[model samples]
Target: MKVLVPVKRVVDYNVKVRVKADETDVDLANVKMSMNPFDEIAVEEAVRLKEKGIVTEVVAVTCGLAACQDTLRSAMAMGADRGILIESSIELQPLAVAKLLKSICEMEAPSMVICGKQAIDDDSNQTGQMLAALLDWPQATFASKVELAGDKIIVTREIDGGLETLSMALPAVVTTDLRLNEPRYATLPNIMKAKKKPLDTIAAESLGVDTAPRLKTIKVSEPPRRAGGVKVADVADLLNKLRNEAKVI
Candidate 1:
């Protein structure tokens, strides 16, 4: 069975983001870029599946500028057999990304697709579901554990209240959560091997997916600074302040 994993290139989580002076978007010039942390978990999960002999091939795909090839290379270094890059300089929203991925899915025809529950950059948490909808396949989101049995896959997902378990047929979509698996760092040898791995680049437009922005960004700005907490001398003072100064009784 072949598994497809998709990753996104974003500003490194550790880096502090700054809004551009013109309020257009986050300033990315000369900033550190890396793979989305959640997507790393997805790649790790796919690699683990391949290591367990449950999957024959793990293919990693990313859609973005030419720089996104680096993110795909990271997936290959983590044990993906090959990499596919849908090249586009423009930033794609979740829906457009799902559409492009749907096109790739039709061409690759993998047994399943693995993705991060959400990308940290957008935090939309919509691509996997959208892709599953577009593909008309079963979807398991926020999967913490996954097991393969025959033609079906059992997934344990993290929900609001507690863990929920579900079994879905093959050719499903699984989105990784935080506890899915800890991503392993690529060793020097593996990194070298990844350089030789087959990586094919395709123009996003060739997929025939409309890559237009349906939503417009009115403005991007930094959040308001939080006010400092105030201290009260006693319960009486606090009550007095709450009733009079704070106007909340």
Candidate 2:
């Protein structure tokens, strides 16, 4: 089975994000960017499947600006056999990305597709489901554990109540969660090897998928600073504060 893993490049998790002066979007000038942490888990899971001999080849793919090639290379260094970059400069919303991945799926005809549940930047956990809908394939999201048994894949995922397990046949989609597995760091040798791995770039338009934004951002601003807690003299003071200042009562 050939597994296709889609990764993304996003603002580094450690950096303090800033809104642009115009309040249009996050200010990315001179800011560090890296692979989405959830995507890292997806890549790690795909690589482990390959290492276990369940998957014959692992292909890492991304749909975004040219910078996403770097994210694809990072996946290669982690053990992907090759990389495919769907280069597009347009604002890539979830549906646009899902369309691009659907195109790739039709082209590559992979047995399975793994994706990060959500991008930390947007926190819009919609791509995987959208892709599955477009392709009409079975999907499992927020997966904490995945196992391939015979011709079926079993996924254990987290839910508000507890854990839920799902079994799907080949050619299914799975979106990874944080608890799936820890990603291995790219070793020096692997990094060097990744440089030589075949990395193919395709113009997003060439895929014939419309990369258009459907939603408009009204504004982007940082949340207001939280007010600090205040001490009270006794129960009566606390009650008074909650009933008046806090307005809870």
Candidate 3:
């Protein structure tokens, strides 16, 4: 079976995101860019499936500017058989990306899709579900554990109430959450080999999927600085603060 994994490029997790000076968007000028952490986990899971011989091929695809090829290379280094890049000049929103992935899905015909539950940049957490809805495929979101049983895919997901297990047939979509699997660093040899792997870049417009941004960002700004905490003198003082100052009581 073939599994398609969608990876995204975003600011490295360690970086402190800064809003643009004009309050238009996050400052990307000379910012450190890397694969989305959740997407990294998804790639790791797909690679593991391939290693287990459960998946014949693991194809990594991404939709973004030319720089996103680096993200795809990272996926290939992690064991994706090949990479597909849908290059777009404009910033892609979740719905647009889902539509593009749907187009690619029609073209690739992969039996399953694995993707990050959310992108750290936006934290929208909507792509996988949107893709599943667009494709009319069974979907399991926030999957912590995934297993293959014959023609079915079993996924254990996290919920506020606890874990939820779901079983879906072939041709499904699963989104990775934290604790799914730790991503493996690409060894130097694999990193070098990834350069030689087949990577095809397609213009996003050629897919006939509208790549327009439907939502507009009114402004972007950093959150207010957190206030320092105060120490209470005793239980009475704590209760007094909670009732009078903090207002919780």
Candidate 3, 131-184: lDDT as tens digits: 999999999999999999999999999999999999999899999999999999
C-alpha root-mean-square deviation, candidate 1: 1.7
TM-score of 1: 0.94
Could you tell me the TM-score of candidate 3?
0.96
The order by descending TM-score is 3, 2, 1
Which candidate model has the greater TM-score, 1 or 2? 2
lDDT of 1 by residue, 1-249 (tens): 999999999999999999999999999999999999999999999999999999999999999988899999999999999999999988799999999999999999999999999999879999999999999999999999999999999999999999999999989999999999999999999999999999999999998999998988889999999999999999999999999998989
Assess candidate 2 and give its TM-score to the true structure. 0.95
Candidate 2 deviant stretches above 4 angstroms: 232-240, 247-249
Ten-residue stretch with the least lDDT total in model 3: 203-212
Q: Alpha-carbon error at 238 in model 1, in Å?
A: 5.3
